[model samples]
Structures are given as C-alpha cells and as structure tokens.
Target: MPIAALSDLAGKAECPLLVIKVGSALLVGKEGVRREWLTGLVAEIAEARARGQQVIVVSSGAIALGAATLGLDKGGRGSLADAQACAAVGQIALSGLWAELLGSHGFTAAQMLLTLEDLEDRRRYLNVTATLTRLLDAGAVPVINENDSVATQEIRFGDNDRLAARVAQAAQASAVLLLSDIDGLYDRHPKEPGARMIPVVEGVTAEVKAMASADSNSGMGSGGMISKLQAAEIAELAGICLVIGNGQHDRPVARVTGEGIGTLFLPCRKASARKAWLGGRLRLKGSLVVDAGAAAALERGSSLLAKGITEVEGVFERGDPVAIVDGAGQVLAHGLSEYDAAECAAITGMHSSEQAAVLGYAPRSAVVHRDQMVLK
Candidate 1:
C-alpha cells in the first residue's frame, strides 16, 4: 500500500506514525455514526499496525451526531452554545464507537479532545506530544477531535484537516491520509466533464492552489478542497506526505493505499516541526526587545540572552510563546520564554551571573533557548 510504503521511505528512527483524518460527512450519515464505513477503516488501520505502523485518527462529526441525539434541526445549530452542547453530547458517541470497533479488532483506542490553544502553547504542546508518544509506545490507537464543547472561536469549520497535519507533526508522523468524500484533487471540480486527477504534488504551487474550490464536496462536512490544500501545505513544511482520497467507497482506506487512489503531496521540511509552527503562526503573546548583537547571534543560530535584551513588551507567563525583536523593530525570531513578564523585565539587562542575585534562585540563564527558538 502506498500509504504504508511512505514511512519506509522516510525511515523514521522510531515506529512510523500515520494520521487518518475522517470528515463529518463520511463519519456521520443520516442515521448517526456510520458503523459500516468506520468498521472497514478500522480494519485497514489494524492491518497497518500488524505491519508495524502506529495510527492516529483525527475525526469530525461530534456536533452532527450530538445534534441528531438532541433532536436539533439538520440545517445547523441555532447558536454557538447549542453547537457546543451538541458536541459535549456527541463526543461520547464518537469516542465510544471508535473504542468499540477498534477493540473488536484487538486495538485499544485512546480518545482526546483538543482546542487550538493546546497546540499553540509550547508547554501544552510538549504535554500533548509526550502523551501521544506514550500511547504509541503502548501500542494503542488515538482517536482525536477538536474540543468543540469549549471552543471559544466559531465552531470548527473543517479545521480537523489542518489539525490532522498538526498532529502528524507533533507525533513525528511520516504521512497523513485525509479520507474525503471526493476522488481527490483534479484540474477542476470532479463533476466537470473534462476534469483530470493529478497523482503527485512535489510542492503546493499557485497552480495547485487555484485548483481547489472554497466549498466542500461533502454536504455534511465543513472542510472543502481548500482546507485539504491548506493541510497539504502544512504537511509539506513539516516533511510529512499527505494524501486526499475518497473514503465513501467500500473498503476505502485499503483501496486508496493499495491501488494508489489519491493525490499525494510530498514533503520538503527542514526544521523541527515545533520550530516551524513557531515561525508559521502569527499570534505572539509578547515581544522581547534585544540589541543588534543579539539579533545577529540569533540569525547565526544562537539563543536569546538576558544580557542582550533591552526591554520586555507585554505580559506573558513562562513557557508562553513570544517574539524576539531587534532595536529597529524587526522581529528576529520567535520562541518559548523561560521566565514570566515581570521576571523578564527585571532581568532584561542583567548578565547570567547576576540573575541569581536578583531572582533569588538560579535561572536557566538564557531568555529563550536556541532549541526552543526559530529565526525569521
């Protein structure tokens, strides 16, 4: 199977992790959780594991399933609260279904619900990563979904595609299989008469971007071709191959992997995924103003030092992500802070030796460690 072979090509030092993202449309049919389809997918996953692969599933449809149980209108939830309530109820069904099916196939299923902040915060990112590593080591499959019940932002609009990419990076996965309702990327919409499928993508260029449509093919899922393309971009940056295939077909995952029935995007990533994430995201909790020397050192792959820092500009806790800015207002790098805002303010201009005197306890010395930072 192409999906199974992809990891052998990457040759990860540890057992290769593979992520499968199932959208709401395929997961929740008119009756509720689509048991027949899910059972087949789990069977394929079990087969993959028998061949020494670790799989994680990122799924959507909590709200849809919950809405069905709650007797809400099929059109959409009336309010965000209603949607959240539905998710709180639906997540149980979703997780239980996965557990039941995977158990039947002799695999333990671990369920997790994550919010955006969980991955954005370095501290939380490490915790999640550690937990995933442990689970994989124990030979269990993880079933994950966005924490819709507590999502403050508008409910997940097929963000699971992107979330799948993030999970792949966090778990150091070699590939992601996004099982969708459509056949995969084409020259135009699949329904169009002359549309042609593109088999492999070395990179996501403008032409590739133009091929995607804003609307989803799956009437039930929020993500469309656009979301899948975005996911491909993230996977590319993280050096993880991502495939989009039609999951509605019988024994879908098996057919896609064995017959190579999907669009495969190759990866060309160079940095640690955590660092790539720090560089890619736009939201920074605060900025640390450093001198010219610090800026040059950062560019040459050095850590942020307290002695070079000139000022601390926003309130942030230790382990929160922040930007390292130069004197001229240019952002040099981004990284996780080792100290809180007040502590940073007090130690901004001090040397490593002097920090112990002011801080009462010895510190880690650098404001941000090189391993935790990514240069712009």
Candidate 2:
C-alpha cells in the first residue's frame, strides 16, 4: 500500500484506539525539547481524545532532556550510571512538560513509568493494565515511559519502540502509531538511491527482516527501522495495527489518522490478553530438558509431563519461570514450574501416576501446564 492508501484505510478504521510512541529524536532537537513540536503533538492527541478515541502516549526523551538540563554533551555518557542519572532528571522534566501541555487543553495527563519487570510478572502486568484502563475510563490521557533511571540492562526493553508495543498489547489498543524521525520502512537505507518505501508489511517475512538495518540516524534515540520492525511484530501478534511515520510531519497523528503518510503493518492474528502476556511479556528464568517424544508433543501444543522430563537445569523453585528445552537442548517454550529443583530432579523419567509416590506429595498435575506455556 502507498502512504495515501494507508492514510485512507486509517481514516476508515472503526473506533480505533491509538498508541502513539514519540521518539526522543523528535522530542529533543539540536537545542533541546522543541516546545513547538511538543505543543503540536499534544494538541493532536487532545484533538483525538475529543473525537472519542482513546489515546495512550509512550514517549522517550528523559535521558536527552536530562543531558540538556545538566549541560552534558550528547553521546558523552561515561557509564550506565551516568545515563540512569540523566534519565532520572529528564523524566521529571518530561512529565512536567506533558502535564503543562495537556493542561492547556483542559485535559489531565497521568505519568506511568514501567520497567520490563512490570510486564514480565503476571500480577504486576495485570495491575498496570487495570491502572491504565481506569485512567482511560476517567478520560485522562496516560503518558507512559520506561522507568529508565532505575532499570538495569537485563530488565530494560532496550528501546521505547518495543516498550510501546508491549504497552499497546497490555492496553488492548487497536493500533500503535510509531512517530519517529523517518517516514517509513524503505527497501534499503532511505539515503541510498533506488531505495523505495515499503508501504504495507503484511507480516515480518524473512525478506522483510533482510531489509532491516540497525543504523541509527536519530541522535537522541537508540532504535531505528530494525527496532521498529521488532515492535511491529509484537503488535501484530497482539492483533494491533502499527503505523510508522515521521513525527516531524505537521499534525502527524491526525494526518496518519486522516489520509496522511506512513507505512501501515496490518495485524496477522490476535492473541488473548493472558496469552499475549504469557507469550511476549514474561522473561524465562531457567530450562527444562525433555525427551524427543515430549518435544514432539509440546510442538503439537501439548502440556509437559514428568514422564518426558529427562533433565532439569538451573535452580528454579516452584512457580519460577523455566524454558522447556528439547532433547537436543533447543528451547521450545517457557512455562511456570510446578515442582522445585530437587523435586523435579527426583521425579525425572517417572510416570505421571508415580509422581506422588516418588515425591511423597504431588506438586501439580503437570510439570508445565499448557495454560502457562508459551511457544518461543
């Protein structure tokens, strides 16, 4: 689809719930937070809300804002701690700007900072979801950003693009609008000749993946087209449409919503909220090695059993997350463990009926219940 065609489709989408992810590059220009751009973006969001559309803003610019405020040179970070500190300072200023901007339009904005852990834990994920839903119900636009100041690399989403996708999934939003410096995904680097724009990506095929490059043109942001595609994949799985375009475009959201410009990636399938959270949110803690027959059954969407368990690695206690590994040691999926490390080790290769006899007490009916499992 061409940009014009996508814009037409976007306009025709019914009661679309929008998730707008504003990149740091557009938020902070060479000087600092471009007040004109920020004001314009907020006005667009306010307008969308007035039209009876629910809008969730996933914004990035904390570190950049902090750097500007602290007079630190861009890209002069000496350590992760330094970047974290910058994010801390920047987040405060970022929230203030959003509050003031939205307040001018007689709309209230609530700040939500989340780390990957919040999405990884089932309880925390539900809590965050409930909070956002209530805020939306109350007609307050929620401004979400990663808790970068306190997030470690292991628990970080690495970039806001991915974070936005997860947020879209969590909020069950209809579409995710990735507002960035670039217009859309191109056949090659847009700077290169003959690199045409790809208007609609139906799915992330191998061909589409090949076209992705990790080059970053935005000085204030970490992600590029590659990260955006990854985010799109997550959104697609969650049954959310995604639009990627230049945030610099005037009335960007309205334009994208009303026959503007961008690449639209349609949804492939819709995963239920519980399934989406289980499949895409939680991070695995350990692995459970199963026999070949067990692997085949699991591949066919069957639950894992103790009879199939040949070995268990890592010291995960009951309820801890663990990857279901095949006989060859390839990870097939992830699920919560029903038994502790010692219990699993003792019951390995035992029949289902023998579980209680060997362990003295049965942990659960299955080693990894299908309900808790998610294919990788």
| Top-scoring candidate (lDDT) | 2
Give the residue spans of candidate 2 off by over 4 A.
Answer: 1-5, 8-15, 187-193, 205-207, 258-260, 289-293, 307-313, 325-331, 341-363
**285-329 per-residue lDDT for model 1 (tens digits):** 899999988888887888888999999999999988899998888
For model 1, what is the error of residue 355's alpha carbon versus the real structure, in angstroms, after optimal superposition? 24
lDDT for model 2 comes to: 0.82
TM-score of 2: 0.86
**What TM-score would each prediction reach against the true structure?**
0.74, 0.86
Predicted model with the maximum TM-score? 2
Candidate 1 at residue 259, lDDT? Answer: 74
lDDT of each: 0.81, 0.82
